[model samples]
Target: MRRGYWLILVATILLVTGYHLRFQAPATITAEQGTANLGNWDFTHQGPVSLSGDWLFFPGQLHTPASFLQTLQTTGGAGRAPQTLPVPATWNKLYRHQSSHPLAQGRGYGTYALKLTGTGHSSLGLVQQPACTSSRSYFFPASAPSSQPVSTLGHVAATAPQSLPHQQPVFSALRTRPGAPHYLLVQVANFDHRLGGLCRAVYLGTQQQLFDLQLQRLIGQGLTIAIIFSMTIYAFAIYFYTPHNRSSLWLGLWALCATLYFWTRANFWEQAFGTGGTFGFAFHYTVEYCSLLLMGPFIIYFHHHAYRTRYVAERLLRGNFAAVLLLCLAVLVTPVEWFTRYYTPLMWLMLAQLLLAGYILLRALHDRQKNAVRLGISALPLFFTIPVDLFANLNGKPSGSYTELAMVFFVFMQGLVQGRRLGLVIVRSQHLSDSLAEEVKHQTASLEEKNYELLIARTALEEANRDLKALSITDGLTGAYNRLYFDRQFLIEWQRARRERCPLSLVLVDIDHFKALNDNHGHLAGDQGLKAIVSHLHAIFRRASDVVCRYGGEEFVVLLPNTSPDQAAAAAEELRALVASTPLHYHDQEIYYTVSIGVGGLPAPGPSQQPLDLLSAADRALYQVKRDGRNGVGVADVIAADIRA
Candidate 1:
């Protein structure tokens, strides 16, 4: 997939570059010794032609068309003739030996003159793009005696203050008359830039052709600006939504800088705001310099955020940011001439940043970081174009809009890389989602099985706990609740009865002559008799709230909630009769047992009445029953008074 994308990107770049080259104006005619003879040339058929050959140069002099014509007519083009220098070149590139006139050293006044000889009268248009620091051109017809120029761009003068620099594209129209030689003169002055004179080519064509060409260039520039600006918006949106990815922020900033810088280059500001005064010029240059200076830092920052790097790249990034910030400040405050002088150093700084970017990218690739290869591939065009543009600027050559095209290409490649990343993320997410669903289904079945096992274990544990509790509270021999159970349950019953204002009853039963029986019939007989008595007692007093406990050896007690003392005594008598009737058959002999019963109750227990008082009253009644006669029942009311006694 990656290789295919790379091939497509390479093919697209090649096709676009070829298309651009194919449309570029070709120079077919060359002038020698300040004259271009196009007697047989057809302007309509060949399209616009670049006036690229040698033109007569007069150094240290700014001349009008009339004065220059006068000088040529009087001098007869003999001694003291103007030295010939190539057009579409800066004065700094002039060789000392090539001209008898003193060189401007890229900072002086000069006049350029060209003579043209064409066949018939035709309407001609001169399209001058951004070429020099300041210049004015004139076209004079030799057929008329008047030396007045038919077209002019700006008020070009020898002094710096009088010269009005027109940086925007200029289109001047003129009509050629038959049987006349035409003169084209341009006066140029440079005091604010590193390289001066005509630095860009001038094209001459039919009026309609020139307008169409200018329109094409403007449309191209507008489209480039719009595309880059859209990328800026996209990057900013990403950054705003996901703040953790700082690369998006830096990319947005870099794209914004590129947009502004290119807008300035396309001279959109002059068109929008009109040809400005001193403040306007200063503002324009300041924005241009600041935008250009920030581009390097922003891109470096973007790279640093896009990939992790060693300390070297981080330090370089910070240093580049600080340097660019300072340069931007200088551009804001300083004059155009002062800041423009450092253009070379600024270019060098940008070059260093590009190298740093390459280093970081290579390291990322070596470490096998994500998107490293994509990013490196996308950066190729920018890397190639920037250095070429820098070289052209340094050598004072016209470095057209190749950098802009390269930037657009780079952005397109980056978009593709980002799109691929998003697609992979979506695919991986879908796979993971499916896997997660399957895992959840399997885990849910396993959990249900484990829960069923746990339910069974819990049921068994509950049964065992109930059995243990029963054993803890029950007497082994009599199968009745033990004294410990009675001690705890009596208080709870008393409290509940007191709160509900109900009667609480206790019945005490003692087996008569138990020791005598044990002595006569042995301990086995005694145990069997006790069990028989307890069974009869439970059968007689069988209520949900009734409690039966073996108080001690041969003694049993029964507690009944919501029962009166009389009712409890009746129940106790019934239990005694039942005990007498029921006997245990041990060793084929029947063992009979009789129990003396006592009843104690509180119809409405007082606040001061304690649970132990009822037990004491019951004990007293039991003693009374034993003293009177065995197997009989007795009752004791006033439990609290008895406890006090």
Candidate 2:
């Protein structure tokens, strides 16, 4: 594993080295020599010289370079002398002789004059400083000895060269013959009120060399963009797989902010999308402010995960996020001028944040947390680069995106730490899984034993349920089905008869003088008689489809499926005779009873035919037997007519 990590580190180093070499700038001289004898300087190998040093500075406005030179000669004996401010510096810092908090002093215009004698090149490249809202340069020679036309001297406007008249010469390009002294006047306006005017070195190089420098800057920015973009993608993927790791998510957002910061500063937005004016201005500052503000929380959260802290890191992380969010809102709504003024302080605040993060990392290192030392080692570049850039800008020196490279390197190292952590988690999980498998096997055997016992209990419960259901339908006294069972069976038989297209018969039998027998022979004798009749009923309803049930007190009902009315009436007569002849021997006494039987039948039940209706007809027939004479079989009128047929 250690070897793998080393291999990865070596590969990354090689890749970055290759990218740097691929887009490397052409070899050129620093040209930091003093402002004298520029004509003797070589234009090819020692390309552009840093035009840094003392220059004649005129605040407010001086149109023509001749006017600026006149102001310089007199030295203003009675009035204020021309303030000798340094070139390649913001007027905000240099104008009042106060060097700090230049933006708070605010907006103005200035003209800087420098004398030079150089041989004519293809062109003189004029690079505008970032803070200069608008600028124009006027070129002059020792004598009017040039092929290019020189316009009549007039008030030199501070507008761009594109807006100037064609006759007048501008500093977009300065053509000259050898051995001629050239005086250059550059006019700059500070509309933004902060970091105003050229703070970077001016270069005088061949057109081809200047173009190569521009290309090199672009290629380097592109490479940084690709590097940061990949880091963002990797962070997001890690967050997606492990949502609990908030550090990964914050790192992704931080990487995204870094990309946007470079994009805005590198002027890629204008080149790709043509986004200019107020929207572009707003977008650039918003991105810049957010990128700076977000760095604090990202570092804190990363430390919270990568190392151990005393819960203070969590609070810091939350506070940092809230502060960044508020700053984002301020950057969006506040005017660019106001924001630019505060940008320096905000940068200082960021430097302080960097220190705080470093303090937390140092604590982690003290505690010897996993990967703490490696992570600190990786972030060393960022710690140095960020302050370097901040101080460079404060001192009015150009510090290209060295901080961006530092951030990429830091994120790459964090990613490696995360990968190592994930690897450890996977190994531990595999070990736990093996233990869990054994536990599951034991639980499975125990569960099977319990399940077998449950199956036996379930079977016994089903049988008990069936016996209880039978008891619910059975009559308690006579061991016959009660009226409730009769009603249910009547419907079943009626439907079955209809389906089979056969007649269904119902015979209602009532014991004659049953109430009198109950009064004289006592209820016990009556119950014995009922049991005797039930035994005869069971014999009569021998067929599986036939049902016998006690309709009510002293009332018995028999259901004969697929039986005609004639057959039903005949069966009822036999039941009546059986009751009259069979004697119930109770307490050494023989008791005889007769029954009045009624028969009702439906020839293939229909929709109009009902089970209750059929039972009612049978009841009416029994009433007729009671009305005429007791102990006789009676058939319904419809069944009697069918039997006659």
- Assess every candidate by TM-score: 0.63, 0.58
Q: What is the C-alpha lDDT of each candidate?
A: 0.76, 0.68
Question: Which parts of model 1 have CA positions greater than 4 angstroms off?
Answer: 1-19, 26-28, 95-103, 119-121, 145-151, 309-313, 422-645
- Enumerate residue pairs that collide in model 1: none
* lDDT per residue as tens, model 1, 578-610: 777877688888877788888888886878778
Tens-place lDDT per residue, model 2, 1-645, is 377776876787566656666544333222222234566677777765556677666667745655655665566555665655566676656654554533336455667666675555546654333434445566667464232323221223443232111111122345665677776566666554356654545555666666666667677778778788887898888787677777778778778877887776676776677655445645666676777677676776666665545536457667777887788788788876688778678888888778877887888888887677878987899899989998876655656556766776776777787777666766765555544444333323324767755644443334333545655787777777888898888888787876777888899989889999999899999988887888888777788878889989999999998898889998888888887888889899988878898999877777556677788889999999999988999998663222321
Models, CA RMSD each: 20.2, 20.4
Query: Ten consecutive residues with minimal summed lDDT in candidate 1?
Result: 437-446
Enumerate clash totals for all models, in the order shown.
0, 0
Whose lDDT is greatest here?
Answer: 1
